[model samples]
Target: MTEHRCPVMIVTSMPYRLAVIFLAGLMALLAGTLVARDAHAQPPHADPAWTDIVVGAGDDGRRLSLTEGHRLVIQLPANPSAGYLWQIEQLDTAIVARQWSSEPDYVGPGDEITGGATQQVLRFVALGEGQTTLQLALRREWESEAPPVGVFTLNLQTVGPFTGANYQYTVPPLTQPPALSPDDIYAEGLPTHFSWCEQGKCTPIRDQGMCGSCWAFATTGVMEAVIKIQDGVERDLSEQYLVSCNTHNWGCSGGYWAHDYHQNRVPPNEPDAGAVFEVEFPYQAKDVPCGAPHTHHEKISSWSHVGGYGLPSVAAIKQAIYAYGPVSVGVCASDAFGSYKGGIFTTDESSKCTGANHAVVLVGWDDGQGIWYLRNSWGTRWGEGGTMRIGYGVSRVGWNASYVVYGQTPYMPIGGATQPRVRLFLPAIARGGGGVAPDAAPVPTPTPVPTPTPTPQPVQQVPSNGGFEDGRVIWSESSQKGWPLIMNTGSLVIAPHQGSWASWLGGDHNEVAALTQSVQVPSASPYLTYWYWINSADSCGKDVARVLVNGTQVDTYDLCAARNTGGWQSRGVNLGAYVGQTVPLQISVTPRGPVDLATVRRFAELAFEVVGLDYRDYVVQDARFVRPADVDLLVGDPRKAKEVLGWEATTSFEDLVRIMVEAELSNPENA
Candidate 1:
């Protein structure tokens, strides 16, 4: 219009201007994306007032004011496949409140199998004005002897207002995977039926009595899933362990599936959950207070939240179950749910099962049936024999689901690095296998023995091919029920006292095995010599081997309580009495203790029942008509002790335990 400026400079500037505008817009878009990512790196309630402590920072102690909270960000070097886990061992809730914990953010240097790590932000708020200590431990939950890898202790205080605000803090930007859409995960295909139970990866069905402790069972289910998915090991995790120790839930009064799954939970007088076996902490219907933590067999490293507590997508729920093993979910249990048996249950949309009242395990899903599988805790007598099937579109079940991770490395809280599992491949062959396997060394067959020329040889070898050097040639070995003794044990460590090959006579209690051979000692001084080893190994073991010569027992030996690698023992007997005679020689070994799991478990149960026996009524009244004075004599033992040895007993053994326990109950401080 201005007749214009068609100059060469103006013509080129148009394209340049457009390029500049495009670049500016692209940069702004990238900047916004980075900012959004950084915002999510921190916990939902990250406050400047809260102090940050890197988990492995060798934190000795710290102080906090009653008016502020603190964050303990742990960058755990985790490998769940190894069954390692981290847990909060000690924390006094009387002085501090474990506010929340975020889902683990896994970050690998490259890939998962090669190397990877996890980041977790655990938030804690000081409750009242007092001093307390927080402790952490890392270990494998399933092992009985696996020691903790390390421990982290943080001494704290809330006695006064802020004093030292000079410690500058820096938070590492979290390396987190992007929020995944369920739709994206399911774009390919969904399995018809995917139950961990079908794969033999789930634990046995358990009952929760009359208490509404579905949440505890759900927690254990997820834990079992984690163990199975990560390590391909199906462990019967203790639901009773969580029911008694996890204080975050209301015990038998109930717990929530969506609540923090053990962020600050600690075992009483112990280090962590899964510390005790189910047999040790049997489940009872009542809301009993926690018992003293004993020898724990399982442990966990940390746990995570899936889709959070509210408004989670069903797609996300399904994706989580696929990625992690099983998931703990919340469902609205209604009148219909109480009577639900076997069938695909779809809540009548007009009247739905509404109210987040029950918790269960989201073990699997079926696209054909359009339902999700729920493993219930109401015993095998109810529902689909302890499992339920629900519709897919239902919102209640997907609302809030969680997952936990396992840890194999041990934690040394005093600032020690994690170590590989110590009890690797240490399964006790005595558990079920008939014969014990060699502990360390593997034994193969030795060189075969050839027959000598038929000369006037006075004595044939006492144990011809005893070491199985020629593969069960002369010695015939058999166990209870005609099971063959393990003749393939070629381990030098477990070999005969003399040779490299040895036979193993191993089984549960009450099972007997024998090795016999016929020898013609047709000469003077017919001496018998052999090498043998025996071990009871476990509390349930009572192994024994006997030397029987011609139906007469010459000597007997008892098995030690463990793998007796103390070298084989040698024994020799002079057979000069039976010179120029042929006799039957037999070596019989028998497992005279508990035979199976049921039998082994009975001993512990019997001990517990015996300890809990209440015989107080006998002290005041006579119920037995025969030999009642023995009871009286037991009642008068204190007087007798006073007369003899000047014992002047303070109390009887039973009375001492009862009185001590009573005194502790009256005054908890004594405990």
Candidate 2:
């Protein structure tokens, strides 16, 4: 294992006094604290008779049967150095148990080294015979308010015990391809090359990973580049928004870009649909349900194919790029294309490169060299920094080319004037089997034997009117502006999760609604389950729903950028620790205005500029942490800072960012 050293905190170029103050601010904001662990690092229940089953990425949604006392090991691909970690997000503890004692096995060379690819391993022991689900999220700990970058869910069924030898498995270490110089391709006596991408202007190349969502990436790529060209603004649109929310086409499994954008509009309300910001719905590289976060979208006026279904001429494609910025094109991505590192890519084998299936973007072309510049969804490590130069017409480079026309006007917000209503439909709860009638009149008397009332068992007691069926009879309800907490049949779209009524948390801006109930925690089954659905036009951080027990926050839901739950979805909370004690359970929601994506983009750009780094580095790429929402952020006043530190910001935000980057690069450790 390599020694893990923290990045040296170095502040240079600026005056010593200002540098000291800046360094202090950086230390306060960039501590990079690790996340807390709920589970132990040691194996909880070690037994010689126990068996083990190992699983890894792509094993999500698997249904596995495990005997009691057996353990299931999940090993997910992770890069801790990249500031992302995989942790258990959800688990049915009644069915499976985890402890903190078991240490995970590090399967890569640079175990704690920066920028190392590592594996996150978690072990769960089957508790008893029951069905449960296990969910894990890959994310940066500091970005707790943001959605996970990746998710894995598994369904587990524990069966009768049967002792077997613990399975032993080996995970292969991750490796990178040999570095190939782009100079090798430039030296090949190629013709003059022309590109539309200006330094720090073009949209950054993105990675599609193991998913087949290249079509969505291609569409967003062209749209983003065109927006930069036409509006002089850099926007990072959500490709995952189309991959998950666009129902007209399949997500991840594969679909055409035209079908995703042109055919599918934002649903449940919004019609002027296009692409949303990447922060709203981060890509999971899987088939996720259409969540509510996608409702806030950027509307495009129109899009059209450059040429018909047939292959387009190189000149036509070039003209489209010159007019609209970049043209989305389809091509056959064969093994040769996949293995491409450098040099002009061309293949003569038709059988290998069959139909124009995979989608990519054509950014520029050189007629003299008979080559076209294409941007791909693979990571920067692939090809030449996620770009390819190919002979015109090679690999079906110009097939099904298309471009997006700029929107004539700014799009109105989705969900109209007021925030989208939190509509729910809960079925009526039915109480069955009053009691089993005693051996129906054994004597055959004219009067039938009355059903015997069975003695009630000491099972966990649910809170009275827990489902809101009694309309707040046993709960305390309060809200701003006298809005009712319990919503009863106000509209056709409004209903309950399981009854005719449900708790409506928030609607409209500047509203704080809350519902609370006092209940003695059940000892037998201490888990409390409830259903909730959120519909909001608010942005994250500004608007949130918090769950509390005994006045302490237990869970919190950021309303903005949250998955709408489609309908009411069940969530569980274990009150086992407070068993037999009466506690106040509350759900409070506060809705506010959304954080503008445009504003966020501008902030990121300015901040990068302050540090003297390229704004493109912050604008188009994924962040290791979620930024503070507009409402939650406090801009520092240079005057106040000057009074305290005897100095004020003297340069542009870009210069500050550049200075930080330069200082880090100048460090001897980096060398």
Candidate 3:
């Protein structure tokens, strides 16, 4: 306004002033936007103090402490399609603020079923330093007057500001037993029958569910029993911590006791290096990513093979069980083995012996009955209240016998508290008045047993075409008029994960395709296992894949979220609950929006072409990048290459792109 300059100068200055004002406004807008975003954002994923509480993993009635600004994630099973949805019944907003809740994008085999059982994931943040209670109810909205089918409650305490501190509780050490001479150690004689379980020294039987994590259960069971016997205190160590946190062991897919016990650490016997408590890390029965800054509550001083490799002698196993509380051993766990309800289980030629496929604990022995008492992980409904009697040499009952001596130091939470223990009562045994015969010559324990068994019922097999290799012989399909989306054996475009055939369910928009088969579930440990691949062109919630049992949705896959499977993923569903019933198993795919078969095909071809592979081969057999890492910003600079390596590209940009596409297609990873 004060400018009184030449006409040309005045015009130039006006434009300059306008530019400055425009830049200032933009700066102010950006600053305000950033402040608002920061205000509403939740804690970053990198936050070390975030806690994830998995419901049904024994998280109920537990009190948890968190510092202000920390996050808590609660996962609960839900079936919204069946009119059962989870809702917050009560929450103290003054102390804790609800962020948001949504359904998970992917359902794994552990939770997969036909009954539409999915997970509802909720997140909350501590707002102020105070105490509060979080409660949720699962019920139908229309039936508000009725009681909820399930309820979940958690006690939460929000401490002051975040202070990165190790909150630890020191376990009062027990009085060490006096060392004895060799003669004194051998003074005691073995008994005719010995059972830590009968003496109330054993932990409750745990159900591994559909997971093949018997090794972890067996390991933790022995640890719990030993802790009780040595310290005169019962402890429920976490099988999940061993399953998930141990890098040397495969979670839920079977593992070796030697590897988990000895090789889990770098140098062996690392301080505070052992399994956490069950309440701190509950059993999920599936692979979960190991969390950061994990704390161990117990450790083992030593573990060794009882009889030095192969099948140990029955006497050595008995001695180990007597001296070491409980011992872990590998078993065959055949279909017949699961069906052994009572009496000594013995194997015949029809049993089809393979090798040790499952792990269990040899809790005791009854020499009079010529049987060994084995504790199982198949829940209280199986065998004799989650235990069974096997003849000394049956089903490789004592192969790979190993015992662990617990470390004297046990850890507790910062509050100097231990989680409450849940005890399981075993069913009473009906014994005859006559006792067993005296100890006989020690014999080698049984060798390995047959595998792929189910719960205790007669083997009611899955559909003959469960793998989808016989075309559609035993399977039925339904789809839209033009899209025939079902299992394929003829298409070279999408190869099967295994044999010569597999199911291909989605291609067109606004289309629904499903495959169905009837399967008879066994009475015990019945489960269905299959492999699947997801190649989706659409994002999450736009296209969906689902598994239904008897017309009820049990599992669902969000196309976009599951796209990262990269290749065939094995999934299983437990059918033990549906014993003796033949139910329909259905896999269905529904695509929404304006997409067509041609578009889907084109997208797939383009994606696979870059790797020089057919879509099926790239997905099923040739996954180049197992998991691609993310970078916030990545840019290609030809100048850097020229300056650093003194190299210049001769190929044209267009031709380079074409060559890259061909190279990627022919790559072995995409073969």
TM-score of each candidate structure, all chains considered together: 0.33, 0.34, 0.33
Candidate 1, residue 65: CA error in Å? 62
For residue 425, model 2's alpha carbon misses the true position, in angstroms, by: 78
lDDT of 1 by residue, 1-671 (tens): 21111101000011111000000000010010000111123443434555664555344454434443455555554422122345567888756655432332333222101101222234466555677888766544333255677666777776545333312223222222222222322312223346666656788787665455677778777776666655777666555656566656456545554223233355558654343556777777556667776565545666667756653565566656665568877664432455566665643221222334456788877643346788877667666787887665442665457766566421112111323222112122243554333333222323234323122223243445533545455555554445444333332213222222344443333435555555555353254533333333343234444555544444444444332312222234445445555555655555433221111122222333354632221121111111100100001112334456666334433344456555656796755
- Candidate 1 segments whose C-alpha is farther than 4 A from its true place: 1-193, 231-233, 257-264, 273-275, 348-355, 407-671
- For model 2, residues 1-671, the per-residue Cα lDDT tens digits are 32121111111001111100000000000010001111111223444454678898878899998886567888887643233567668887766765322243334422111122446566777656678889888865444577898999999998855332232111111111111122211221111244767434478889776566777888888778767766778988887877776756556545665433633455554444666788878888777876764445554567778777656665566556655567788775433465567655644212222345467888887542336888987768677887887765565666678777765322112123333222111111123633212222122213223223233223224566554555646556555536455544442133332334544455534445555555567565554444344443334445556555554444455554332322222234444446676665656654322221123334444555555654442233212122211111112223434567777345544455567667867899998
* Candidate lDDT (C-alpha), each: 0.45, 0.51, 0.50
Instruction: List, residue by residue over 1-671, the lDDT tens digit for candidate 3.
Output: 33111101000011111100000000010010000001122332323455554445269778988765456777676533123456678888767765532222213222111112445455677766788999888765444577997898899998887342312111111111121122211112354456888878888888775566777888888888877877788787777766676656466555667334433463233344666787877888778866534566556787878877667767677777776668988765433455556554644211222345567889887643346899987777667787887766565667678888665432211222433232111111123763222222222223233222222222225554454444555555565424333334343233333344444554544445555555666553354434444444344545555555543444455565323333333233434435576666656655422221122223443555565644433322111211121111111224445668877566543345567677776799988
Rank candidates by lDDT, best first.
Answer: 2, 3, 1
lDDT of 2 at 314: 58
